[model samples]
Target chain A: MALLHRRLERSYSARSQGPLAAHARTLAVDAAERLGRLQPGNDFSAPLMVAVAVDLAQANAGATARELLERTLRLEPDCEPALLALGFSLERAAEHQQAAATYGRLVELRPDHHEGRLRLALNLIRTGRRPEGEAGLRGLLGAGTPTWVATLAAQELVRLLIAEERLEDAGEAARAALLRTPGDQRQWILLASILHSQGRRPEVLEALRALPAASRGVAPRARYSEWPDLGAAASQSRLGELARGAESRLAAALVEIGR
Target chain B: MTVARCVPLLALALAAAAPAAGADIWVTITAPREGEYAIGEVEIAAEVVARAEVAEVEFALDGRVVGTLVQPPYRLRVDLGGQSIAHRLAVTARDAEGGQATAEVSTLPPPIAADFEVELRQLYVSVSRDGERVLDLNGADFTITDEGVEQPLVTFARGDIPFTAVLLIDASGSMFGDKIRAATAGAATFIAGMKALDQAQVLVFSDQLLVRTPITDAKEILAAGLGGTEARGGTALTDSLFVALQLLEERQGRRVVILLSDGIDTHSVVDMEQASALARTSSALVYWIRFARDADNPFDDGGVTMTSAWRSSQEYGRQIELLTRAVRESGGEIIPIRRADEIAPVFLRILDELRSQYVLGYYPDDRRGDGRWHRVRVKVDAPGAEARAPRGYVDD
Candidate 1:
């Protein structure tokens, strides 16, 4: 095995030896320190040090882990793993402000890094800076944002609006998600449910009708909003027919949730 | 090995020899990673090192026995199901000397399977007239209908039935300060009321399960577990409820889930519908002790009422609707109190009601496990005799 990787494995093995392993923490700390002192000539030194830091954090030596993370960051300021590990350790300790600052640094370093920005926005919300966090979420839902990140941002923004009693805005946000990510079907369920809650029957029917049709002859269960089959339920002939002819708009919207 | 190593080894030996004190068994779970969404056949592996000769390790799903391991690598693989739902795994280890120790871990609750059980259903019914409980009713005195079809009772028991309960206290960030203290006191009151034969587990959850004691009749142990908890997360009410049902699903006899919360769920992946389905599946009565957010306008509290619906998040309306409906369908009641002080009294009152309730079980005539909601109605024949039972059940 490679020398650094072998040391890493041995360090972990020492920690998990048993309850009687009194030197487990000390051994782990020593291993991390030794790895940190490794010459910078080895290309894997930085990443390996970051891994040892994460292992230290998991072993409950978080303070020592932070020290190692700092050393890694000093050597490689743009180290993504080191930043994320440090931020996550802080977040786990409920130090949301510190975590947010760490994430902010990562975001500044890599503006287009979707995960970094997402973590930053989440930490901002956790630190009680709701308005800025809400704005951050909104900014991520633009044209270039990945589908996963946009979906998450949309969910968070709508949740915030809903918490603040801005139901109409939440509905709009859900609709915005549908628009931003074209051909995305999941948002349609979210949009229909939001509209159904607001009693927007026409729009509810329109959203449900817009759902993708691919299935054959599946029936609609009475309760659709209860989280029906995921994906497009429009293929269910009964659902489409119900959406068109059902007297109750809420009933019609629920019918297509068979997806 | 140095003397430093020998000291820890000696301590482990001592800890292992301490049998009756329950200090010998040390269990640390290594699998079913907490934050990861686990589905299909998830492995439940734990590193258990005991002082005594390790006899066997038993793993349970909810309270149901899943599997037992007699050797090293104390692990068992469990099928959580096709859909991701909140699953609580209880692992109990028994040494050769008869010493036993147990620990519990819960999977991150996910959106559940939309189905119900077709087995024998137990309904915990409480009858009252003029705000007084009429506890002397028999099986002959009551008539039950499933989907409007009259069904014969398979098992009927009145009072004296020992019940297992899970007291769910919401220790969210909003529940900080006096709210948490009141909740703790209330939980203590419920634990104090449990009979020596009755078993209960206290689950204090915010975004995570902060305190979870095993099902025990020891009041001091239950009360001690209630202390030192800091309220600091969003309320995961639905997920917590689903966890409660999972914890109670395997326990025999009558089961009760008493929830104390001041707000709608803000951090749960498991929605109310899935929780509702699980409630019906388990047949455990769910009592929600809601502390009113607004004293003056009760309807404006928790965004549950129709008047309050337009104000809060759209999802809250459905959550409150489904949550309240699910509680009622489990034949349990919701008590809303404006003051934090009313918490203990409400908890005591629910405990009293549980002691006086009647349990009826029946095999549904509709044998087909058609995943449809059934309308169930229970009636009493005597004059002014009001019977409170589940409104219906979902026959999955």
Candidate 2:
């Protein structure tokens, strides 16, 4: 009788475990389905969808990837990842504003996300937000960022500032960036630009001439060669002609150095 | 005074009996500017006595001989159509060398008629943050407010509508490396996406504008130009856009311009404000694609090393924003694409939006030629329908 009772208990325990496992699987599927249904079309709904999709996709229920993406967006429109995903999707779908908003949300959420930040910066550029977008990038670089991200961000920022005729700020930013990463060829070019804008002809020439030889950490040699050092001669001459007295003399000296 | 009056009446009676008449010469030159005139049509009229012997009259423009007419008190009209702008008109009459007299006439400036019309043809699409092919509605979506009242949309249509497109490429020296590749590719993609019947032109500008191909088959011209792109001059984006707008002005259908550049107007003769005005008046949509290098580093020296990139990117951002504003004001959108690979899909999406549009045309009751800009209003009477159309049209 005792043995029969033990056997019955064991059988019941095994049956109970089977149902519990099934329930867990069912819960996962349900979560995935909920996520998949959340397709948020706008900035407000993109992030939520992304987060849920990430969660579901991570769980090995690969089939729920789309569903997970959809549901989270349906719940919270402004979720960041969801926004990024939605932005990416919309971009793929050729919906620019919706995508821009998603990227903008990503920028708001993770300012340090370089990819997100870069994308937002680019979008802002496309939309004509020059100073603000550049300032954002400069702020990031000023925070002592590392390696390639810093290099790329600094290079782009300097070029834009120079183009916009913000010489003083460009000079300061370029100098600061150069101090941190001296091997950056773009920074050197930027320094030359600042000096040129400031009418420091000799300094500009020196800066260009002082550019280190193609080496580790410096910009590619091919890029450096494309700088048009000799091509700037006409502009330098024009600057010299425009300057009077000491300024002209200084410009001449710079021209000589450039030569 | 009474005697004088009687004498005048006597002379008038004698003149009436004889019906005596004299010749008067008048010349009219219908050119836009005094310094510049096309070699088109010039009208000259001379009133003369029935039996008067008017020797010869000579017409000249800018010291060069245009034509000569030898007839009594007669009207002569010269057609100088199809001539470029930069000519003048001077008329001289020579009954004899000693009796020769010359009359010079300066042409009036270009007319600013209120009845000017501009249409938005194609809207370029680009990928946004959410990975969707969307139109950038910055400067393009303008609200028409007449006397502080909002107007309604009269017509709206997508890609199915016939429109003119201009592709402006940057041949600036700074657009080197991957940018040149991407721009060419983007342009090719845009051309590929156009409908067979659609017309598009490709213009590459740096210090000057160069029209690589006129509005024709997108596939053939695009393929020929896309692979041979060379970057070697200062940026003149503003000037390029202005030229594109001018070209689009004569077009009957919708007009749009797609600009590919790094957003640096280094050597543009025209400023942003002027460009903006031209864009607004012409109602041309401007789509700017900014090419930026990827950021692989996140931290170094308080992020100072990234300043150059940041500033350039930001300037590009501002230019785009301004362009967006321009487009939106004209009921168009600004599309921004980051990845070069995104160009094709974005172009396709723009084409799709254009195709999906529903065009609604209506004739208003007010048809007075008042020589004024009139506001147009279009509204969706349906409960949930949306509408879009030109904010206004000029009525003359």
Candidate 3:
């Protein structure tokens, strides 16, 4: 029986994606359930349950997912992934304070967990604790933080400032993010957007025209290369495609600008 | 012969002689698929199969009539009453042949934050040359394809065809004062420009519905829908857009959805793929008037940046990708603006573009309900002329 369970695990791992993945996972989950039924539950059951919960959520089986996550948390209170998933679920359900608390537990378990920090901060903002949330986001911009996390932090901070009607602060934050990762595509777009928001059209055009091209062979993301990075996406169905190099993107932006 | 044996033989003979197909009505509940957590209000959709023509579909919630729908894509919105208990939702489709099909979905309490899948759509198009609207195009002037297979035209119109639109305004917390006002003004302007023949509804949302106006051409009603709303919640752009698409599905003629958002969807349960799926299904023109940068893909450091909420950076990236595709696929475009002030003009300009458009549509030769992305391309026969239509539709 144990060998069978192991085989199920191996099979699921082998087909973790594609059409057969879900079937493989269902088999693994059923095996896991049978194993739990036959043997005393232990630490092994918690992670397995968490994985099952993730699958359930993906399949739109949210109630079951929530219940499984709850059971998993009860068994292993410090499960980071479980905590994160529960927090997100709560946030989605519009229980911001509860979501924050769940995220708080994850943060306590792993202080450096990037998502935990971001979501906790976000919930704080939703609950009207803007300053605290802003501070939390600012902390993610520390030098030791991962580039991706920090970049997101910068973007969120800029967006928060922009939302708060501090246009200059938002622009400064965008520039600061650019300074951190000068070659980042999105930050440049952010900076250009800020200038445009301040009603500086010529400057917006200048800034975009100077956008650094995608770095050597960086696999173009769907949006970065093909998705209209600039122009009116509202219906570009009728407009022309603007893509690839910097100039093309600028021309797209120009279309939106009515320049 | 024994009497019992003779009866069994007669019944078997009658059953064997009966036609094997299309004898019974089939109404299958297709949405709220898992019935696990249907948070907020969900659109109950059902697929009905019947040999007889469907007369009407009665949507009942907890055994009460929610609405009577008369068509394929039988759908109706049901509020979950903010309960965490189980509830029974059923749909009964009655057809012209007097056959009835009944489908029911029991949604237990603790519903999701937002999820409602309803119906599907086709295509809208516009052609331009040298920075000007190419007004003189005809059905013969364009060629089209679906999923790389060329399709013949089914319908063609080049004038100001009547349309129904949904002005999806984001009144999330970030849009508190000026931003919300500007978005409202823009939506109002669009409503004002609507011809008596053209009707639209205003759907304002921030995590949940702030305001929803009935589909109408009355400017006063439209203005009232836009009047005085506070932006104090999280952004549920995808969920709100799903609702917008649902509204468009029931309308005839060209359907349009003009979304005013910052591209950040924090509280939506629908996510991007589902929203895009609904867009393709509704075949409505989606105009995204964006105000901010594309939300960052958290996958900058492999998967380390993934949010625990399962909105992993990878997921977020995929979300952004699908959303961009949804916009393009809807034969609509995104108009990115920096400030609140530019919103009203953009809305008016979109109205003008709607008027200038040449709507063209075609049925794919071998595509119907296969649930696949059929890439579409439209080419203008005239030199220097270019055409734009949605990238494709999901014939699911």
Model 3 C-alpha lDDT per residue in residues B126-173, reported as the tens digit of each score: 887886788987789878877777777644556565678999998877
CAPRI grade, predicted model 3:
incorrect
Candidate with top TM-score is: 1
How good is the docking of model 2, by CAPRI class? Answer: incorrect
Winner on lDDT (1 vs 3)? 1
Give the Cα lDDT of each candidate.
0.67, 0.51, 0.66
Of the two candidates 1 and 2, the one with more favorable lDDT, higher being better, is 1
Give the higher-TM-score candidate: 1 or 3.
1
* lDDT accuracy of residue B261 in candidate 2: 67
Rank by lDDT, highest first: 1, 3, 2
Candidate 2 lDDT over B1-396, as tens digits, reads: 012233334433322122212322222222222454223233444322212234666767568664566764334443332222344456565543224445555553233233533221222222233443323332224333443465343322222444578888886677776767777776777777776446788888654453456667557866675667677655557656765675676564456787776555644434456567556556455555544433342112122221121133334445545665666555555555556676666666666655544333222334355635555544433333344444454443
TM-score of chain A of each: 0.60, 0.48, 0.66
Where model 1 places Cα greater than 4 Å from the true spot, the runs are A1-110, A113-259, B1-118, B301-312
On residues A96-201, what C-alpha lDDT tens digit does candidate 2 reach at each position? 4554677777777777766566556645654568866786666657554646556666766776777788888778878888898786644665576467447686
Runs with alpha carbons beyond 4 Å of true place in candidate 3: A1-259, B1-122, B293-314
Rate residue A212 of model 1 by lDDT. 44
Docking band of candidate 1:
incorrect
Which candidate do you rate higher for TM-score, 1 or 2? 1
Cα lDDT of model 1 by residue, B23-91, tens digit: 665555666655555543456777565666778888898788866878877766554543335778777
